[model samples]
Target: MEVENEEPSWFVYLVRTSKSALYCGITNDLQRRFKQHQEGKGAKALRGKGPLQLVWSQSEINKSEALKTEIAIKKLRKVQKEHLVKQAVRFDRK
Candidate 1:
């Protein structure tokens, strides 16, 4: 018998906190993650920052790559994250 390989689907997302801060994270289910954040059940760092805005997100082929990309975005400064959000908004508008 032959084994079939399955592709991984991962999501890299950015959420804007109530303080206008950006939080970067990766998950397999974007909707669930967003719900968790909204419910204050997500990352401990994000607690008390409810009503977050989904600023940006992208899908990746694998969890590892998604995590790496999320880490890279998280390492960016606030200004950089803002710039990214603006760019994404521009693309959406276009």
Candidate 2:
């Protein structure tokens, strides 16, 4: 039997492309993932979508939760995602 990984080091991140498109994904190493995306080696959709900016990230979550959050973000409409980015930043700045 396989044991569950309860380590809460995973994160869900939102990347904004140069074209103003938002991409949601989960990763444990945010910087590494961002580098891969920049090099066109991360998500196929993000390929050629250079100049990605990490607009939002939620960390200290386990892998399962990160995956779930990624899906939830993906299912949201563009406007909703934008609103999420906006809201996520407000707390950090204040």
Candidate 3:
């Protein structure tokens, strides 16, 4: 048995729904997660809200940071999230 030394890079992502709503989530596998969202397979809130777009994403973060950042972003108002998307600000920090 062996262990891989490198850790998976987690990401905090914001998706824009067809109805102008933002969905926040964190994943180590960004591509796969986004695919699930697009297919309406993950996040019940986004199931009926089709045509999602990956508006913003911050990469190269650890799982802990990604989860924390997702929570913080989820707590923000819509306007604030739009501002974040507009700015594409790097908010994840140690």
Candidate 4:
């Protein structure tokens, strides 16, 4: 018998709160992460404002890159984040 890998290839993502706030995070499973936020079990700051809507996400080849990306995103201001999201959308359209 062969073992199958069910895990997602790690990702760094951003979720948009109902108030239009951007939340930066990293996770291997986007769906599970989204569910956790929805249940108010994710980040403390996000607890009351969720169920968050996934606004952007990008997969990385490894955990280190994912963490780096998460940190970079977390450092951005709201305007920068919006620019990033727009860039991502443009990239995806290509």
Note each model's CA RMSD in angstroms.
Answer: 4.8, 5.4, 3.0, 4.8
| Predictions in order: lDDT | 0.81, 0.83, 0.87, 0.80
For model 2 the TM-score comes to 0.81
Off by over 4 Å in 1: 1-8, 89-94
Least well predicted 10-residue stretch by lDDT in candidate 3: 59-68
**Top candidate, metric TM-score:** 3
Worst 10 residues of 2 by lDDT: 85-94
**TM-score, each model?**
0.82, 0.81, 0.84, 0.80
Task: Output the lDDT of residue 79, model 4.
Answer: 94
Whichever of 2 and 3 has more lDDT, that candidate is 3
Per-residue alpha-carbon lDDT of candidate 3 for residues 1-94, written as tens digits (9 for 90 to 100): 9977766599999999999989999888889999999988889989988889999998744898788888888888899899889998987434
What TM-score does candidate 1 get on C-alpha atoms? Answer: 0.82
Q: Residue 39 lDDT in model 4?
A: 91
Backbone atom clashes (below 3 Å) for every candidate? 0, 0, 0, 0
> In candidate 4, what are the lDDT values of residues 1-94, reduced to their tens digit?
9987645488888888889999888888889988899899888879888657888988876787778778877776789889878787421211
**lDDT by residue for model 1 (1-94), tens:** 9976756588888898888878888899999999999999999879998678998988877898887787777777788778878887421211
Rank the models by TM-score, top first: 3, 1, 2, 4
Clashing pairs in 3: none
